[model samples]
Target: MSRHAFFIAGDRVVHVANPCGAGFQYQAQSHVLSPRAQVGPQQHEAAETVLVVQQGALELMVNGAAGYVPAGSFVRIPAKTWFAYRNVGDVAAFVLCRTAPPQPARGARKITIQIAAA
Candidate 1:
């Protein structure tokens, strides 16, 4: 098993934990979304995801339903559920995302899909 600690910087999504890097059962990522930036409209076929809001606010659209997620809050998205999020505050939004059973490495086998916006 590989184990190491690392730092994540910049205003982009960074995987903090993964099978290849940390040998963790789940994949953890740090996302820094600039104001008005959006992400997803995608679905995880076999992995459930949990999103923790660390700073700023976000508008989450899950399974076609929209809701507000403020700092210090979190949201769970079940497998196969379509989700998307956008920074709703003027400042950058920091979010910690974890997906269980770690998503397949890119090109291994597609377990995720990009869906059309509603």
Candidate 2:
């Protein structure tokens, strides 16, 4: 049996899954955020990401307009488009993230990713 590998990066918990060895085209991870926390502005050059919210609420900003994403809903973020999110509710947000055309793993170095003030 194989154990699931995961790590924390900045404010997000990243769950690493098998895509290459499992022969899947997309890579998958589960991410969690505390109330009022956010993640953003990064683009996936290789794949279009799909985010499914399993718990709490998310305020997703794409192209400068923010939309509310509720729990049990899914959103498709296109490749290379800059997007950001915020958890507006008072509960922890549980989200499932998947990227097609799975890119290589990111560096393990601890780094803070912040979007410039607009």
Candidate 3:
């Protein structure tokens, strides 16, 4: 049996059973954010990301629609879509994010948002 365990605390960390495993499946990972920390407007180019709020509350803005993702709430960001997330709560926010078949062009570019008068 393969031993896969690690400490996941304030300073969140993740340990894969097989670091060099080859597959095209999404993996669930835990993440912790400090107050006011944010991530956004990123495109995977190949993989899709889904964020699930586990402990605290988070402000999620996807494709111009805003929603509050609290514990038990989930948000899915399609591959190559514009999206962002922010922790607006008083305390740190805990979230579980899953990604599929790592994108080859990960972080190579960002999605631009433009606003026009209606």
Candidate 4:
């Protein structure tokens, strides 16, 4: 088995690359969101987040702004910017998420913030 080749298990979210797993400087993950499913309105304290839409569409709310990202498109969320995403299409959506500088070994610190209802 090559260190460069790895398989992600079938899960809602799977870490494909990480310092502990792939010795990467950044962390990469795969997310599968069912129709109408949604993620967090949270922000990373230090790492920047980049999301790539592989299939279906997503409605994104970032720092009080709303945007529609279609398949093949991507969005960047700077550190400390609150963001959330939902699958807008009537199918499963696939997303590839990358976070640079990776997260702290103890995990990211979750902060409480109010996001306007979308």
Best by lDDT: 1
lDDT of each: 0.74, 0.73, 0.68, 0.74
Better of 1 and 4 by lDDT: 1
Please give the lDDT score at residue 84 for candidate 1: 99
lDDT, model 1, position 5 = 22
| Per-residue lDDT over 1-118 for candidate 1, one digit per residue giving the tens place of the 0 to 100 score | 1222222333323333344643334566778999999999999888888888889999999988899999888798988889999999999998887777445545454334333434
Q: List model 2 lDDT by residue over 1-118, tens digit each.
A: 2323334443444555663655445666777889998898678787888887878999999878889999888899888778888899998998877677544345423335544433
How many pairs of residues collide in each model? 0, 0, 0, 0
TM-score of 3: 0.64
**Candidates 2 and 3 compared by TM-score, better number:** 2
Total backbone clashes of candidate 3, pairs 3 or more residues apart or in separate chains: 0
lDDT of 4 by residue, 27-73 (tens): 66778999999999888887898888878999999988899999888
What value does the lDDT take at residue 106 in candidate 1? 54
Q: Is candidate 1 or candidate 2 better by TM-score?
A: 1
Ranking by lDDT: 1, 4, 2, 3
TM-score for each candidate, following the candidate numbering? 0.68, 0.67, 0.64, 0.68
